[model samples]
Target: MSKSDNLNLPIYDNRGKPLELAYHVTYTLRLKNGYILALKPGEHIVRMPNLLATDVKRRA
Candidate 1:
């Protein structure tokens, strides 16, 4: 995916306030089945997916 398609999701604190200097930039790819795959560059790749999944479940 192109850089323009990346999502810059803000990092929030426990109080639900967005952190001023923290942000997560995800490279997104849209699948044929309409699922979006977001990839964040770095070692957090292993842990971030589960966090994202839980967040999606809550939102859904």
Candidate 2:
């Protein structure tokens, strides 16, 4: 595993909606420029479209 690995962390959207992080998000990353290399399969991978929320303490 690399330093970028988050160990399948939970991800949510800005609207407080739970998102199913999966391998389908690979297309968003540029494979040629090397901005991203590969994505972890069968794990909850957070994409840029979502936010990595540690907790909901800020919720009203």
TM-score of each: 0.26, 0.24
Tens digits of per-residue lDDT, candidate 2, 1-60, equal 647755443434323344455654642222321123233344333444323233345333
Q: Model-by-model lDDT, in order? A: 0.37, 0.37
Q: Candidate 2: what lDDT? A: 0.37
What TM-score does prediction 1 earn? 0.26
Q: Give a tens-digit lDDT track for model 1, residues 1-60.
A: 646866555443223322343256544332211233343344122222333344644467
The candidate maximizing TM-score is 1
RMSD of 2: 10.2
Candidate 1 whole-model C-alpha lDDT, 0 to 1: 0.37
User: Which whole-number lDDT from 0 to 100 does residue 58 have in model 2?
Assistant: 30
Worst 10 residues of 2 by lDDT: 27-36
